[model samples]
Target: MRRVVLRGFSTEGGPRPDRTALLSLGLVVLFAPLAALSLLPLLWPLRLAGVPLSLGYTVWACSAGLYGLRPVQLALARLLWPVRRPTAAERERLDLVWSRVLRRAAVSERRFRIWVVDLADVNAHCVGRDLICVTTGALAELGDRELAGVLAHELGHHLRMHTAAAAFLVWVLLPLQALALLGSGLALPFARLGRHLRRTERGFGARRWALIAAGRLEAGLRLAFAAPGVVAFAVKNAAGREAEYQVDAYAVDLGFGAELLSALRWFEACAAPAAVAPLVPGPRRARHAAAREARPTHPPLERRMAAIIARLDAAPAAVPPQGRGRGRSESSRTLLP
Candidate 1:
């Protein structure tokens, strides 16, 4: 671990941006203009070289949110999202685990708000700058050690600015998401009409025209509204996966490799029953495999576990820190896999 500083927070063993986090910021820059173009109808023509006031404002807001201004944090994290709050029992456990994790990293517990997600799957995530959410299932399933590892991974995202940059990218691209939804949805009716015309055999020329028109319309709408996101995902998801690996490295460096590896085993166990099920009968399996290959958001679970094992194998033996965090005995450490 090296000394690093981020958004007014500095620590000896803190988060730093890796290639993936940089790539996320790059995507935010690349897509912001396209999103502005899509939202042009919302604003009348104005100054700033065909860019509207709204786009400028969006840039400002995104920048502010990225650096983690308190007001922006409150607005973006508190009001805009209907995130589930932790129950009393859940909070008690979360607080104890969280304090240890943050303490080890030298991050302020005050800097982040812990929330609970009402999900059955074991997962945790960070968003914007200061929010770390763990699923209810995770709270139920993971003991303090395993939960600490998961939380460490998310805290790494915050320190590296992964979630903050991702939030900016998502916010700036909202217009494009909206456009895709509206334009692509309208194509279904036209598609049905074209099919109806083909069945009626309405004069060969007219039927041909109907097919051509509807097909072109659907294709154009898809290209214009829906395709950019796919292209962007193709460009960015690689980096996103790499960022996960980097955070895994961070967790290892921060002394949670063993704990995190155990957590991954739990995830693997949870998924085993489903992975062993018979494949859906058809070429669909091949198509789905191809799709997963084309754009996987996270590295495969096995790959992550392998990487963690490799890190743990190569790491030096754990040396006690200057302070005994939470006054736990050295025998109970979660450093090695």
Candidate 2:
């Protein structure tokens, strides 16, 4: 058996303090004191029984909610993000590239399962502990090497336990999200009533203005209630973008730097039309421009490519040339078998 060592590639990219995680942690810390104070009255009786039940019950409830609902969450994930087994042709094409990547990483084939999703977006991701999902568009758009690079990047996420962390974070924020949803639900009737009033021809000028004002008030209230969750989402996505960079570096360390760069360039090219189409002087262009501003979960392709290039430049000798002899060479071993 031939051993392929990743020279100069340390998996220990030390202590990336995710700002989103920190923000979430900070929110929890802040909430703890407030919760303890708010629940003090209710928990007074329990405290009389020699239990610090205010904080204790809060902690227990949260822990139970997160852990107990985990299995249900996993099941829901599968249902929501359904993927199919790859067709024979797809399997054959992907297996060659995937097997090579696995061999390079020295990971057991049994440890992970790959599924093809019917999505138009050119992307792939790691789900949970052992599931890697690739979109049909990704297979269509990326070359074999580029595809391998994507898979390697997702694998990096898996190896780093990012998926698990993300799951846990989602669990932590679930109640907040539910509260936001409930706020929206409660506000919906008021909004509908206001709209109905505004649309009524019978209404006088002042009445019409009053209905509009009511609508605005309801909207404001809804937004106020949902603001925390919205802020949390933005923070979480910011951290997620940082994770993308880390995973990109991991792929680079695995000797897929150039391939990943190429893949990013391909994404950039694909996005160019949507980006440029908005700039063309037309009414639809405004909508297109607005759509273009809608941020994706991952960092910008240019930023990701730059990060990968930086990694490549930092360890130029670590990227072994393809088709090189297995015998000792100055450069790192070829990652693609």
Candidate 3:
């Protein structure tokens, strides 16, 4: 159980993005089609929202749907498409927990299911109504209070329908992922020629040569046509971090802010010893990550903790003191992580 503190505490900061971020994000408008086009065929089997169409329409509509429903579909895909089946006991326990939480959250049980995956990773997330997966490691590492906090955070995603919001982003990025792959392949060859051009321009004092080099760089970028893809990928990731803050706010509103904060801290501690693994590169990963700024789905842990703290300060809660307490309080049962 979470130990309630009567003292007030708040998150360190709030969400804000500058003009450059906004400008960068604008690129998504153009790139969404590319991602939608690429990812549509893969998702056609789901037939979500009853918008089945001719093959041509499938591509067009899917590109459009990427903006609206792809996230939800992706979430469903992640939740249900397990590489390994869950143990029966774990499945039953997870179902019970999910059923109870859904009732409390006033969500339809039919709309979602929470499944415990036996993976050892300390992570838990919801992809769609059909599947919510919590790694066994995460459950084992956290106390019941902390676990509830994590669940509440995930539940916040369901309540706010963040999957749909995420789909809007995916529509723009599916194409970018492809472009990134192409761009990475071109990186070495282009960089070598680009360096020679720059050196020749400096040594020979050639204005025309410099201009030509600049044009080549521009042409190379255009040929690669990676800007829209790159920018879309970056902003899509930025939006995901923002979504994390919004979900944290949801936990606070539900009176589990402290628990969530504690859970986050514990998760960070557990993850600290592990070397930071590259996300996409090499045989197991993609390579473009080295060439560009890396944007990720979650906010920085310190920043996230700070945001939670700031929220706590702005609106204090009367948490009942633990252990030496008088009569048992109902609120104690609903401890935040």
Determine which window of 10 residues in candidate 3 has minimal summed lDDT: 284-293
What C-alpha lDDT values do all the predictions have? 0.63, 0.59, 0.52
Per-residue lDDT, model 2, residue 277, is 28
Best by lDDT: 1
Tens digits of lDDT, candidate 3, 157-242: 65555544454445456555666556556565656666677666554566546657766765676556566655665565565566
Worst 10 residues of 1 by lDDT: 283-292
**1 against 3, candidate with superior TM-score:** 1
Q: Flag regions of model 2 displaced more than 4 Å.
A: 1-9, 12-74, 200-209, 271-296, 314-337
Query: TM-score per candidate, in order?
Result: 0.72, 0.66, 0.59
Candidate 2: residue pairs that collide:
none
List runs of model 3 lying over 4 Å from the truth: 1-30, 33-60, 63-85, 183-219, 222-224, 273-295, 313-337
Better of 1 and 2 by TM-score: 1
Better of 2 and 3 by lDDT: 2
lDDT score of residue 135 within candidate 2: 76
lDDT tens string, model 1, 1-337? Answer: 2221111223345456655678788888888778777766445445445866766666645664454665565455444334477888888878998898888888877878888766555667675677776766677766677778888888887888887776566666667666767677878787787678777765658778878798888778766777776666556656666667777877877877777766666555543333321211111111010011112556566666667767776442342221112234234434333
